[model samples]
Target: MYTLYYIAGIATIISFVSNKEKTIQGLKVGWKKFSKILGTYLKLLIILSFILLISDQFIINYLGGQAPFVGLILGLIIGSITMMPGFIAYPLAGILVSRGVNYMVVAAFITTLMLVGVATYPVEKEFFGIKATIWRNIAGFLISALIALATGILYGEVLI
Candidate 1:
């Protein structure tokens, strides 16, 4: 939050100094553009956000207390399919950890949360060329899987 505020302040100052009149006009244009985008995505965002919330809580309360290896697999499966933002995963993972879920499983889930987002595929392909984005995302997903597996296993050993 602080970083975002600082960046916004800096950008505003820079624009004001660069050309005050132009900056004011640009700010108006930018707001309109952003508002339009928010309006367009509002429904989809609400639906997806709800789904994420339900899924995370379900996983934490139900699947999280199982054996570490089983929980890891479940976490990976959930992470791959979940469209929730990575930012929300941290607290969810913490909750699962408190519920007796292994840290390694949570780590794997967090890794997948950031690396493999099925929901972002269409936009990612459009922005970054289909083949390039798919390959990169796949590679990232694989690396995240490996990291989660290794870290979870290590954490399980240490904590146990």
Candidate 2:
């Protein structure tokens, strides 16, 4: 982490020395683009925090391997509802696993988070038509479920 910062700083310095004007221009453009997404990222962070907090409690209290099917259902529901970038989703999945979330549940959550598009349905429907978009999402949801089961089998969490 610190190494990345150091490398970036050194590279920036070299870039500035090689072409100060171009470096400044690039930095300005990058900052502008990053700033636009920063607010959205912050909002997602808050939402993820609340979800993890609630889920941690639930997992510790009741979900404990005893109700894997219910946990997987919750995972699928939450993942389908929430739209987030993979950068955030991956880390969130790791945190959930560390918090005692079942591998199958985490797999279902991560798979659906990337594949299913409940939150983006409006935009997809506008471009692809309602029927096509709806069918595609349905197919993707089924595929995600399969992937989750595969992940479980690979992890030795599921038999046969």
Candidate 3:
């Protein structure tokens, strides 16, 4: 769906550039616009990547070498603070798992990261009405708890 939207946007821009009687060529204009947008996103990505790198090292040191419970707490705390897109969250979770973090806790952290965002409450309230947003978040948190429990049980079974 997002890819389709991106393709549609690119097509629209190309058509518009072709129609325009510009001093520069159509391809040049399109490339310039695309490059500007890409550059902006890349800059933001670089900044965020640095923050994540520093944060992971800080968390690992703070939690000690082998502490799954500490990782769970720190992950949840970071998840609550960080508001990057969901796509980034999964890869981060995978990295944490590979580092010997608990899978169930990562699942809970991911759930809470997406579903129980205090930062998004104002925007959600304005769009969906205050009461509706509050109720939905509450329900989402509850479901996230159940998912965490199930994930823990499943993983424990494998360990045993």
Give lDDT tens digits, candidate 3, residues 118-160. Answer: 5566556656888998898788677766676677679882242
Cα lDDT for residue 36, candidate 1? 63
| lDDT: the better of candidates 1 and 2 | 2
> What TM-score should be assigned to candidate 1?
0.64
Inter-residue clash pairs, candidate 1: 104-152
* Models, CA RMSD each: 4.9, 6.3, 7.9
* TM accuracy, model 3: 0.55
Clashing pairs in 2: none
Q: How close to the true structure is residue 6 of candidate 2, measured as C-alpha lDDT?
A: 100
lDDT (tens digit, per residue) of candidate 1 on 15-90: 8998999999989999998886664366556657665666556777645776767777777777766766556777
**How many clashes in each structure?**
1, 0, 0
Alpha-carbon TM-score of each model against the true structure: 0.64, 0.60, 0.55
lDDT of 3 at 25: 67
